[model samples]
Target: MQNSILLTGATGFVGGAILNRLHHEKKHSVVAVIRGDSHLQMQNVPTVRIGTFDSDTQWKENLVGSDVIIHSAARVHVMNDTEANPLAAFRKVNVEGTLNLARQAAASGVRRFIFISSIKVNGEGTTLGTAYNADDAPAPVDPYGISKMEAEQGLRKLAEETTMEVVIIRPVLVYGPGVKANFLSMMRWLNKGIPLPFGAIYNSRSLVALDNLVDLVLTCINHPAAANQTFLVSDGEDLSTTELLSKMANALHKPARLIPVPCWVLQGGAALLGKNGLSQRLCGSLRVDITKTRNLLGWTPPVSVDEALAATALHFQEHQ
Candidate 1:
């Protein structure tokens, strides 16, 4: 069945992908909430521009008859530091803004609220071989993660109090076309033919393709099994750092320039500079188990990591 959907973060990566998919499928009436003027890609879609997150604007009125609410907006990283009170900034939008909209949604009779949360809510770094599942407790390590974790908690509590069904999806390291930040940085390194010293690092981490994530979001929007559940989703397969770079090279149609460098030596260098913390994230193994998601929702990621990498490479090539 088709329904009107209220979506936030329409200008963002994941949100934009879902919007495109919805348009292509002709599934629903989309009301996009953007902070500013709609991007060229979103200009044709109906939108409500509100500069402030806490504004009790008439946007809620649009949600009166909406079937689902997908909250995707969050203050992503501008840099790698806790320069100011990051938790405060994250809360201003992630926590408070979320509740403000959710409360209004429930009041307006929206049935389901789908939250796009990060896996960082589980923890910052990872343990080798072991992977985090849906049953694990949240132990957010950073300000951003803490804000998301708090939002999840608050939303769950609100769901218990109201008729709104809240579905939380935690995705890890989503990468695809038009991706920026760490993903783009890695692409740059590969494109430039830079020889990486991570050949010996064998750490497996789960990743989700943009298309696969979009598929999951669409399913959660209306699936009966998705109501009031927290699901950890991924591509189902994990990839080592060396294997990932190799796949990337293949996608770019370039030769791998990977060199074997012991993990201990890299850690030693980072320790000297007091940046051992970063080394953990860069070379750490962070895998997610999506068994529960499949069993419950009867869903799986649609794209393989290889296909995702190929698509990303083609996109970058066109842009370049």
Candidate 2:
């Protein structure tokens, strides 16, 4: 049976990549829900324009008859959020908006709803050698994460009340072409051969490639075991700050000019500069254990960390 898939965030980074892949594969009929005016011209794929995500917006028309709804759209973390109430702003979209959509989807008889969430839902960072798994209690630390946690709770409740299956995925740092924010900044710095103070930092962090994440999403779209399940996804390989920088440098064909600065010194410097969060990210150990995803779903990340990094570097270079 050809499943009609309703995809939100089709214009954004991860969603765009998934849209392109689905379009290229031609296995399923796709209806992309985008915001505002769209000039996206793609053959065989229909587009729906929803002005904004809120209580008043109607989604039943676009949601009806869809077999699966891949909801990738959410108010992501803003480094310096300017909103008067950041949590309220996030809740409006990530929580309330998500529940609204899920309600519509359930009423419309949509079979599955896949929600893309963040690992911050697990917490900021982890202890060395300790990895977070799907069973870990949610410890959302920020507004964005709190909103996602609320959305997940709402979705699960909706699932219990209705037949629409809800699959929640909390993915660690996702990197690929068209990536932005801190990952993009790191790539640019590596490309320019900037010396970093993370050489001695031995903190392991897990990351998922865009392709790997999309692959998992596609798997969950049809997999029976994925129904009403929550997952933590990563590349299955972990890397330290220095190791990651070195790998990125290799991908960029540049020398890893890293100075060995103690983790304490880095933390102190970042605190002095009012960049404590940034320092934690640079020096913290946050790993994900994908044993459950592997054993339960029978899925694996197809792209290696090296391959993904190289592709990202190449794309960055070409775009530059």
What TM-score, over all chains together, does every model reach?
0.96, 0.98
| Window of ten residues with lowest summed lDDT in model 1 | 54-63
Tens-digit per-residue lDDT, 1-320, candidate 1: 78889888988999988888887788788888788665637457888777788524445566868888999888875556665788888888888888888888888889999999999899865688799998799989878899899899999999999999999999998899999887888888999999998899888888999999889999998889999999998999898888999999999998889999988888888889888666786688889999999999999788998999999999988998
Q: What's model 2's overall lDDT?
A: 0.92
Candidate 2: give the clashing pairs. none
User: Judged by TM-score, which candidate is best?
Assistant: 2
lDDT of 2 at 25: 88
Q: What is candidate 1's TM-score against the reference?
A: 0.96
Instruction: Compose the digit string of candidate 2's lDDT tens values, residues 199-233.
Output: 99888999999999999999998899999999989
Top of the candidates by lDDT? 2
- Number of clashes recorded per candidate: 0, 0
TM-score of 2: 0.98
The regions of model 2 sitting more than 4 angstroms off are 41-44
